[model samples]
Target chain A: MLAFRKVVEKMEGYVPGEQPQEKGFIKLNTNENPYPPPREVLKALQEKVTPERLALYPPPLSDQLRFKLSEVYGVPPDQIIVGNGSDELLNIIFRAFLGYRSRVAYLYPTYTLYRTLATIQEADYLEIPFQGEDFQQLPSRFLAEEADLKVVCNPNSPTGTFIPMEEIEKLLQSSRCPVVLDEAYVDFAEESALPLLPKYPHLIIVRTLSKSFSLAGLRIGFLFAHSEVVKGLLKLKDSYNVNILSQIAGVAALEGLNQVKENISKIKRTREWFSQALKSLGFQVLPSQANFVFVRSRSYESLEKVYQELKSRKILVRFFPEWKEWLRITIGKDQEMQILLENLKEILGKEWNQGA
Target chain B: MLAFRKVVEKMEGYVPGEQPQEKGFIKLNTNENPYPPPREVLKALQEKVTPERLALYPPPLSDQLRFKLSEVYGVPPDQIIVGNGSDELLNIIFRAFLGYRSRVAYLYPTYTLYRTLATIQEADYLEIPFQGEDFQQLPSRFLAEEADLKVVCNPNSPTGTFIPMEEIEKLLQSSRCPVVLDEAYVDFAEESALPLLPKYPHLIIVRTLSKSFSLAGLRIGFLFAHSEVVKGLLKLKDSYNVNILSQIAGVAALEGLNQVKENISKIKRTREWFSQALKSLGFQVLPSQANFVFVRSRSYESLEKVYQELKSRKILVRFFPEWKEWLRITIGKDQEMQILLENLKEILGKEWNQGA
Candidate 1:
């Protein structure tokens, strides 16, 4: 028999969504920003993230990127630790802060990856599904230390349900252990928990440059916590986790925050407009604080027909096999979203009046 | 006080060697190659590791890079796993294979990073120092399963010592646990354990592009193992551990293998010329199989004086505080080595030779 850890052997690994290559596809599968990143990104990479630096090892902590992120988030540089993606930050949190003997809790139908990360860390995993109060309030049984760590996906993934800040604060006040607030989609959310950094040392917020900055290609994600916890993550992180191109691009994106804001506004508008159009049909669209919206299929035939029609039209939307009925569509550019609606209308009904 | 894991709380983390950025300095501190990667690297970045791919999540196993590495090593893609660097690969091996309660061993004076990785993995750490005789012929005590895994830094770092392949085979036959041969600097070494990969299912050899391929700025490494172990690492790794740029450069470098061979030849030639010069100065130089030489200083003063003199003359080298009298110098371009020799000759006569 092969020599390997039982924990690793028994685990089914996490696989991310597909990036289909066929052109003319209105891709709304992965929740990526529809607009390009700040102008500074393309400009600087050709200049500063140049051939010479590519010959030497990049800075261990990526000092400049940390400083820029700290300035934007209003946190000290020492309290910031970055990763290849916000996913990597979450990996470090579970791997370093919590022991395998410790337990972790997250709501089901939230970011499903939390359970996968906890399992990989070999921790006791617990899930309190988003059943009662529409996932707004923490489960009553969870107020006590059911787990050593609790990960709350703010404006949670898949469902796009935005829980109020007060409930999170209340959970923090009574929770048995440290809490991680994953805000990967927070740029499109109503507000972020970054402002709460100073008040709560036990609260950790993870952010990514992927959605808002339009830089999913150059992997850059960061976690903000009490300096002590950040220090713990630093201790566990790979020395050269962030490459030079990313560090340079991250600094550029932060400096040109105006462009980032513009892009975010464009996406936010498209997201709202798309939500209204989806609801115009019989689909029940969840209130989303992310770049993507979750719509429940009214009729099983309609769901199957719409999915197949969109794919045939070279438009892609992610359908979860776990929750087979609901569809997750990323907010594409205005033109792309319009094409999706038109194609969707044709699939639902031939005429505009009959589309409902 | 923060409620972190007790393991990380008491841990004093490893500090990597300094990478200085002084103008006009001939940098031989870290063992980075002097040449830029072949032109194919830039071409691949522009043509393959694109902005579009970045927008979506990267392929988890990086099938393309794995396939390229497998072809180079004459193994199939299933038998390999890629990482941000061999450092991350080593971390995965410890977690997916060695339990925290299990013991792990390595050479004391070899890549000290192996011990650090093991400690971070919470494996019981064991080390056997480099004494006399060939590295392959470890002491009888090393074969015991008290250590669940052993890491052999082939053509070892700091002290460039090479062990015969037969000796490694002997250990695999005798030891109860798995053996990992870290070939991070193996391009500079005379031999590799890759040919024996087919026969030894327990062997896992880790390699990197940081040294010979001239892509230190791009942190990419690969692992070769039995398909079972490779799958195990994949299940345990962070999905996007290797970023877009590194993946692009890795394939190009693999395609340009002849260019890499030429680069390694130049480094080897320079290594020989410089080692002979050091030997003439009465320093005991280990016969290096890698692109660097580890020289023992007769005393702490000699080491300190040599280090200071090199610094003042705009030259840099790595000195281990733990092994205070040993200096590890990377083989630079022939002209850069000349600068180091001239600085060493003038300084040794002035300060290091004063007492002698």
Candidate 2:
């Protein structure tokens, strides 16, 4: 028998939101941008697909992308590192700081991939639950726990609830260990913890182009930190984590930020409208600062049935078993969201009329 | 102070071959394919750059690329896993099998990245040197050393010397532990250990499009192993390691194997010509099966002077500090090789006349 490390043997791989191969289904399960990236991004990609470009190795540290990100975000280029995706950045943090004897802490009902990564490293972790019902407040005990690494997914996934910047600062101030502020969905929100990077040398903010820039398929992500932290993480990263085309696409996406901003505005508007629509139908919808809304019905059984009904109708939304009564719905284009809303209303009304 | 893991603090990162920023140098430092990938690859990439594709998350495991590789390599689709590059695949293997308490072994003067990876994982590693000066035979002690994982870089880098499949089988037969046969440069060689995979369930064959397929910039690699091994490595890889463009490009490259085969034949032919040319110039060139030749001079001082002279003339080849008397030169286009040869002749002649 091939002897896999005990940790790998014991840990289950993270299941990303289902990406049905066949097209035409409403794909709100993964929170990808509902629109394409700016035309310039595609144009840049097309221009970059030459024989010479494809034959050479990419710039090892993605220097061009880092420079563009630095210019856009106001951080020095040396302090930033580009990754294959934000997932790679998160994994690097775990590998660099959290090991077998180290401990990691994150909020419960958050991005579950953190738990999977911590498990893979065989590190002890605390999945501290939110203190309140809205899933907005950080657990007080989470601040008190000592860990080698801490992660905060602002505008956290599955729930789409945003923790305030002040609250995130509190965590950064309380912990001396590395704090990975994953702002994968923060562009949809009002503020970012990127400003905290200079104040806290240990603050590593991870951002991806997937949700806001509409380049998820390109796999471009950035990590902003003190140069010292960046240097250490560089030691652990693959020599050329980001490929050539990705680096080119990332630069073009940043250059086309106006288009990305317009899309973010549209998604934000649709998120608000969708949240209100869900609430009007007697579902409790969390106030989302992301491109998705977390909704719950009063009954777990009925909510699960609604989930299945939506799936049957070829409209896919996210349903985590841990949050039995809650369903996470990504805000697609207005028309797609409208179709989803109509299906939800019919499913719930039919269930209510049946009185089962 | 931000406390990095002890392993990260102590370990120096892998320094990749120098990629000079400015153009116009006779670049042959890294062993990237001098030729461009097939035109079909660029066409596939261009066609894949639509907004809808960019907005969507790539298929998590790159199913299409895997299927294409399966068709070409005759391996089951389930047994093949694609990665950002073979570098990522190697990292996954090190993470899955070799950890803090485990041990790894690889040939000395092989790809040094393996040692760096083991060091990052804080695992003990044994660097078994090749038994002979020609670097054709594997060290006798390598088969005896019990390790959790053993890596063999076929047509090993820097030296470009290949171990025959039968010799590799001897190592596989003696060890029950996982053996990773990295065939990154194998397409340029005469044979691969892939055919042995069926007999040795523990054998993992890693191949990359970077060298032979001329898609290094696209970062596509394939790992072929038993489904059981693939399953374990999957747990450690990022959810979407290969981006959409890379996957599309990989499939197209595989489809255009005829072009790639022609390029490989050209590189091999160039390798032989360059080796013979170097030998005529009083340089000892290793019998190279890969696209690069390892050339050494009898005097370290004179070789160092020659390397500097080549660099001064805007010609770049690889000079490793560890191998002070040796220089690893990548075979470029026939014309590029001709230019490199001319420069070497001039430098050596000047030094001989100077008699210093």
Query: How do all models score by TM-score?
Result: 0.93, 0.98
Q: Give per-residue CA lDDT, model 1, range B1-356, as digits (tens).
A: 46677777777676776666556778888888888777788667756644455565566677778888877778899888888877888888888777677778877677777766677667788878765743445666665545678888888888887877877787778776778999988888878998888888888999998888888888888888888777777887877777766777789978988988999999999999899998888778888899899886564444756776787777889877777777899999999998888878787766645663
Worst 10 residues of 2 chain B by lDDT: B298-307
Q: What lDDT does each candidate get?
A: 0.79, 0.88
Candidate 1 docks at the CAPRI level of: medium
Candidate that would win on TM-score: 2
- DockQ for every model comes to 0.57, 0.85
Summarize candidate 2's per-residue lDDT along A1-356 as a digit string, tens digits. Answer: 69999889878899888888986799888899988898888888777657887888889999888999989999999999999999999999899998886899998888999998889888998888888878778787888889899998998987788898888888888888888888999999999998787889889999999999998999998999999999999999888889999999899989899999999999999988888888888889888999999888774444666777889899999988778778899999999999998998787766653553
TM-score of chain B of each: 0.94, 0.97
Model 1: what TM-score for its first chain?
0.93
Off by over 4 Å in 1: A21-24, A131-133, A301-313, A343-356, B46-51, B131-136, B144-147, B301-305, B352-356
